[model samples]
Target: MALFRTSIRVFHSSTRKMTTSSVTRAPFLLSPNQVSELTNSGHTHSVSLLDSTWFMPNSPRNAKDEFLSKRIRGAQFLDLDEVASSHELGLKHMMPDSQTFARACEKLGISPSTHVIIYDSHGVFSSPRALFMFRSFGHENSSIIDGGLPRWVDEGHPLDTAAPILPEPGTYGLPNLKEGAIKNYDDIVANSQHDPATNGHVELVLDARPKGRYTGTDPEPRPGLSSGHIPHSYSLTFNLFLQKHKTKTGQEYSTFLPPSEIKAALDNAVGTAEANQIINGQRPVVTSCGSGMTAGVLWLGLQLLGVKQVGLYDESWTGYSMRPTSQIQKTS
Candidate 1:
């Protein structure tokens, strides 16, 4: 009897350790199939599915209207612009204050323990921004659906066109922002002119805009904003982390590249040595783009690569460019 009891105790201890390990290794990206399984399993009461689609000013499509027309069943619309705080420099989707974010999450039925799964109409585009927002507000139990709505549609998963029924408001508190998760204009300026001897560690600022915009060879989509990259920043267009796929019916969608492919893309973008520095933790990375939306793509990509010391510049280029004294760099 004593020997049998000892074996049972060992088995229970091993099971507990395995369970803890599984929880810690939870993925930040969930596939369309995975999401479907969870929904089908009747576990959605503890999960919040959010459609986080957004478009640039030049785009004609409206995100909310499309969400109303079609979305994952039981999903709610999370308006990026509506939940954000206003920026003095006319930037869109700036990170909201703690109270505002808490209220937004509570209204969305997203308590701290709720597992948020976000998706966007344009595959992985704006969903990362939504995920980043959740993480910034200390909601670490969040993930983005890989390939988003397009992939879900491609997989022949059913979408609901009916109006969504809102869940009861959840109880959430004003969580503090994660340290080093956000970077401001002044931080950028200091980093741009960083002296390793004084600054302690070198930080890499990566621009997620297209090569032409980074080199000042193409006009910015936003009117009156100058086309130029930030000083000491490297251009690694957000699209590099994604790959296009075609459905059986000839519809096309984008999905994130595998980790190996992503590493190769980083090497190609910043050269092998610099990319290695980033991967090996020799430098921290801060991602930026037009209005900080696409920057989240790069941020997510790095997270996928297991790089932890990453930050997002919430104001990004829009606010940076609008400042009278901001430095601008052009390669073309």
Candidate 2:
């Protein structure tokens, strides 16, 4: 009943001007008073993350025992079993095409107005890919459930075994371009050279790739790519932040180190690099890794810490390697 009212309010409010923040945040986060007001004004629809599918079984799931024996309410399972393609695009499970995104959304009853939140069994890799798809489409307020469903189940949330029912997908009311909050490949290179404060809001350029890759000691994931880290990018591989012991009193939640702990780790890395930037500089941080994939894990972590200007370098190494003449500093 409350959701239905909110949906009506959103429709009415759409007749007036809409701010970027209004569309980008989950609907429930909006004040209840504000939501009621929108409903009173006659908005037609409101969207929430509860509508999207959650893919909890990705590459880095816990040992079979630690896996999600229980589930979250309203979640639908999406397996990575033999990768399928949409139409004849001929892509793989790892790199889904735009058409594949549209079809998947349809299969799950996601319209342009539906707020979709994605998460996977793997900590970072698969969820970022789904987040990228939400950005590609015009859906607003799309986010990956950080730390995936394992965290949710560990905390003893309600589980729903019965699968959700879906109505036919409606026509997409997607915007032409600005509909999604995504940065392009070229934009990444241009921003790498820009001053984050003066030119734009840039969070730190943290690299979530392995130290070997960041220091030029390893080959890249994609074929025919030069091996090295991006200039001025700091390394913070996905493995380091994830604590292994859920039972230990000191460290739990596998990922998301408390800020005090993260501060010390960042300080050590910054000192090693000889960069004297503030230990807790309040810059919005962007993360990069091979082909712009792993970096999403870091961005999601920073977002958990309440940093507002988080983003991913969509092209990442793919863009850096393409540069004709670029610097490749091998940090000690």
Top candidate, metric TM-score? 1
Local accuracy of candidate 1 as per-residue lDDT tens digits, 1-332: 01011112111111222122323123578788877876777666777899999999999999999999999988999999989898887677899889989999899998876778899988889999999998777676678888899889888899999888998999998899889999999999989987433453768888999999999999999999998988888899999999988777776667888888899999987778777878888878899999999999999888878788789999998889989999999995
lDDT of each: 0.83, 0.49
List per-candidate RMSD values in Å. Answer: 5.9, 8.7
lDDT of 2 by residue, 199-301 (tens): 4344357777788878877866656667776655678786654444352233243434554555556555544222223323345456677655566556555
Best by lDDT: 1
lDDT agreement of model 2 with the native:
0.49
lDDT of 2 at 149: 53
Which regions of candidate 1 are displaced past 4 Å?
A: 1-19, 22-25, 195-200
